[model samples]
Target: METTPFFIFLFIHLSCLVLGFGSVMVTDLYGLMWIRDRVRFTQVISVSGVTEKFIWAGWIGMVAAGIPLIILKGEIDNLMTIKLFFVALIAINGIILHFLHKKVGKYKKGEHVPNLFMFRLMLSLFVSQLSWWGALLIGFLHRHVTTIINWPDMPWLVSGLILGAFLMIWGLGEIYFKVKEV
Candidate 1:
């Protein structure tokens, strides 16, 4: 059988997803390590800037490649619709986090730290988890929704829900810790 355009699109889509995810993971890991070690403000700022740049570039690359791929694949169905929603959510959260990081880096000793920045960061992380869960759900539903309806056997949905819950708890913990410090 001849190869379908859908397969081509799928390949490109998956490639971009992998690359984008890897970029984010590397950035987050680096940030976590830097923060844990109590790095200098200038070092932190530089690291954040570099990581943020990678994230933006990866995101833009994904978008630039994904739109045409989706178009070529055909009309958006339920799964694609859901996936798009999560993708949009991820983009919004990323933009918010980018600004929040800038604000956080601006704080100096004796300067009153704004809770709004922390709030925004917390929300962004929460939304990031939501996006991941949504993506997982859409992926799972895409495979078996036409035949299966049970919740337990649905790995994607279950994983997504679990991840979402974890994200909420993580965000709450961060808020609690910050409040204690204040």
Candidate 2:
């Protein structure tokens, strides 16, 4: 709200979120489409590879700026802790997915997409979507969604959101595979 230094950092943090998670939507969407057309697999890998750089850059920027944003809030509360937890998830998931990129690279270069690969990819997608979207939602609601739900109810709402989104994404991945086989 303020044009002070903290708010400036906050704006940077939001920009990082846009850069990182926005790229993820593209990667995830193309990855899903790749099931129907092998050529799309290349797009998934290409786009993801290129975007992953910015995603990581944004992640780092968010972290560097986010700590101050939290400190400026001036109270170490539950909501802050919960948000940090999700941020950690996003970071850890990014680390794991960094390695997983090699598998995707191989797939793009004509390596076989085995069942295990698909399973892992689905899981990675879950973590990526869940962490990025989940953290962003929690962050938003923490800041601006108070009109609908009070802060006291946030933990339960976040829990339900995380679990529900994970299940739905997993189910969709399963359905995609099943339908692809048909």
Candidate 3:
């Protein structure tokens, strides 16, 4: 067995996956602390700069490897395109979260992190989770599930699935944020 460029890219991409998921999980945990424990939230976030940096690194690596991996893998079909769409969603959500975190970082120690703001943050997190995990699953199953989607109706089906996931996950996130305690 010989290691090829494709294999190297795949490994880089998958390795980034683990790092990315870990960062996302830790970020969500900090968000939960923001909801449940203000004191701990500040302390944890203050020291979490390194983890946040690691996430950016992983995200960049994944995106960098993904383009070549796609080309190396050959012609993309509907499912692959949809998976790419989810990857775009993940990147978009990440940008949103970046700005939101900037706003959050400006928060003074004694001041409250507003519900509306936190709700927005939670919604962003939900989007991140949905897209990251969705894209990962779709990538893993893409070859196996390629036959399932009808090519002619692919756009509609992909759109519907993305919309449904967004709405369902965002709704659940909103509920959690709403009922969360200080």
TM-score per candidate, in order?
0.61, 0.74, 0.76
Model 3 stretches with alpha carbons more than 4 Å out: 1-3, 33-39, 143-152, 160-182
Clashing pairs in 3: none
Estimate, for each residue in 88-178, the C-alpha lDDT of model 2 and write its tens digit. Answer: 7777777878788876677546667766557767797777786777678777886775413334446657755765776686687677777
Candidate No. with top TM-score = 3
Each model's lDDT: 0.64, 0.73, 0.74
Local accuracy of candidate 3 as per-residue lDDT tens digits, 1-182: 12499779989998998888788888777767766866465665664555677777888899899889877766676766777777777777778887887787788877988776777876787888888887787777854555244343576576577777777876876777677754
TM-score of 3: 0.76
Model 1 Cα lDDT, one tens digit per residue, 19-57 = 666666655566566658755545756776776676666
Worst 10 residues of 3 by lDDT: 143-152
Task: Assess candidate 1 and give its lDDT.
Answer: 0.64
Backbone collision tally, model 1: 0
lDDT of 3: 0.74
Task: Specify the highest-lDDT model's number.
Answer: 3
Clashes of each: 0, 0, 0
Query: Which wins on TM-score, candidate 1 or candidate 2?
Result: 2
